[model samples]
Target: MKLNISDRKKKVINRMYKITLVIIGMVIVLFNDTFGRLEGFVEFLALYFILILITVAYWIFKQIKSIIQLKNEKEKTELLHLKSQVNPHFFFNTLNNLYGLMEKDSKAREMVLKLSDMMRYSIYEGDKEWVTIKEEVDYLKNYIELQDLRYHKKSDIQFSVQVVNFEVKVMPLLFIILVENAFKHGLENLEKNAYIHMNLSESNNTVNFEIENNFEIRHNSDHQGIGLKNLKRRLALVYPKKHTLTIDEANNKYKVALTIKIK
Candidate 1:
């Protein structure tokens, strides 16, 4: 892709600024000792050398800092791009479910309403880094309701939430991927005794989320895609040391537990 003109200019300007600092340091170090009398030259040389060392070190330090900052910004941008990519798959599945519902169910209208609320949230709020826990919890409920409509009450899915504070903010769509994964891989294939259980609870500024479901053994290529990886990457980007995600499977049942400390 072609770089934007403004971005190209900004890059050029940043390079020039760094180069200018380096050149200024070089000039100060090389020329300061040349313009002093011999008697004072030794003292001048000592002070000048110290000043030059400090100047060069400061410039190098700034250069290293700038490089790290740029690298982090680039990684953050790429992570956001990956997060954006996960949405299309979700939209595709939801629309397919809605299409199936429209053919026979009058409740499709209600489903559409719920889906529209989710669509609005995705379109407007998805781009944001953080949203209130209340907003995210509501989004999760709407999503579960939509999935319930699709499943036609065949699956035993339950979601419960206890919030100590609604004002806490968290990264948008952080937990939905696990819920979607549960539906897509675990509950969708089971013909009997299908179940999904989810809980979200907050205490002491930390949010705990858990989802578990059972599935029949089956091989599907699409199940191993980048959704979970993207979710992990987003968690790393947003929460870093303050988050933990664990997944366990046994007896044809899978569970995912995620904990995040709100900032």
Candidate 2:
């Protein structure tokens, strides 16, 4: 029976019950001769009116609070939508201009195109609840290619994907943070023998990603930044107990392994 009543309904019922009790008590006081005289009775009536006014004021306050909360929610949603539209369109236009200025078949033109595709995916698909594994893999590849173009150092970066089903849906942009951190803290800091290895595989209704990179020990201070923190928070909210993230840092190496149960 309790389960049948929604929380809002239960709250309404409780408020009604409380108001009914208050009214009944007030009526009894008004009818009884406990006050002993007309003036006393009049004073009791005044007190009763005050209680009624307080009850009405409380109800009004609750209504106002609810309206404020609803307005805030609507404003937040609109702001997010506006950001999604503005940021993506701005980047798209800028990238298109850059692409046009570059000579045809040039390496810079290729990089700009790759960047445009990546930005498109990130701005449009990243906001979605989920995306196909193929889409995510393509985005990561584009990101890696763009990064590769920026650095002259010959870092041995490798990414391997073995997905049983490309159509399998997963949280968008889940692996990009780890890859970015690897490049930022690992390859960029190391002068020689820098290497990053990454693998993504899906099997038996589970998806797994692993990344290992070698970095200089002196640049380890900012390795654990807001990116990893946000990733952990998101994993906790989205996957809860269904996902596992393991981190290992030793011998001038950093490795992260993530496993998610798709089912």
Candidate 3:
């Protein structure tokens, strides 16, 4: 049987009511006849009342815990749903750009075709909660290469992943999303000598990621785009209060740093 939360709560509530009524009856019966006559019975009833109170309190605590768990699960579901959209949106846009590249540059077309593997992973494996750091790093490399082919401008764009080891696992597409965002919003048609740098490191159970990009900073801006907003939302859902994230933008330079611990 599928037991809804309300049903289980009502059942607990009814049990509590029955216990309360029984205790009231016991108190009435104890006071009426056994007031000064019975010595031990009154003490026993008092102890029983204390036990009943304790049991009710325990049940209430458990109910509160269950409610908290439900809320967390709901938030996780929503975060995953949001994450699911990012890859396809990125793919369609990149593929359209790739189509334009195909018209004249056969080499660019061939390079863009390699993106299909990343697209496959984004569509299939990216759905999972976490993926190996090696996979994520490889994907980031391909993404950077794609941008390199598209940019047509050189010497300004520098990107690399600095890490000690590549065996650990992390939330898939987490760092990659930020890299994509840097290229999307920061790189402009007017700007020359734009630059982006990224580093990743892991020790024990903590993973650190830092990225900085030099862009044409527009005046009076709240933030960059939905991608960065989505990145923050994902971090919140996956890490909650356990992780640390910071972003700094000053004098036309943007930097983001994130530290996540796997427990």
lDDT of 3 by residue, 1-263 (tens): 98899999999999999999999877777676756645566677779899999999999999999999989877875665456344565566667777677777777656766687787767776878778888887787778777777667763566555566677778778787677767766664335777778887787888888888776656325345666677777777778886888988888788999899877
The regions of model 1 sitting more than 4 angstroms off are: 1-65, 68-78, 81-86, 96-104, 220-224
lDDT of each: 0.80, 0.81, 0.74
Error (Å) of candidate 3 at residue 149 is 1.4
Which regions of candidate 3 deviate over 4 angstroms?
1-30, 33-72, 84-89, 219-225
Model 1 worst lDDT run, 10 consecutive residues: 78-87
Please, what are the lDDT tens digits per residue for candidate 1 over residues 21-111? 9997776666656754454655766898999999999999999999999899778766664564335666677788878778787988888
lDDT of 1: 0.80
Please identify which of the two predictions, 2 or 3, would achieve the higher lDDT against the true structure.
2
Global lDDT of model 3? 0.74
Per-candidate TM-score against the hidden true structure: 0.71, 0.64, 0.70
lDDT of 1 at 33: 67
Misplaced by over 4 Å in model 2 are: 1-105
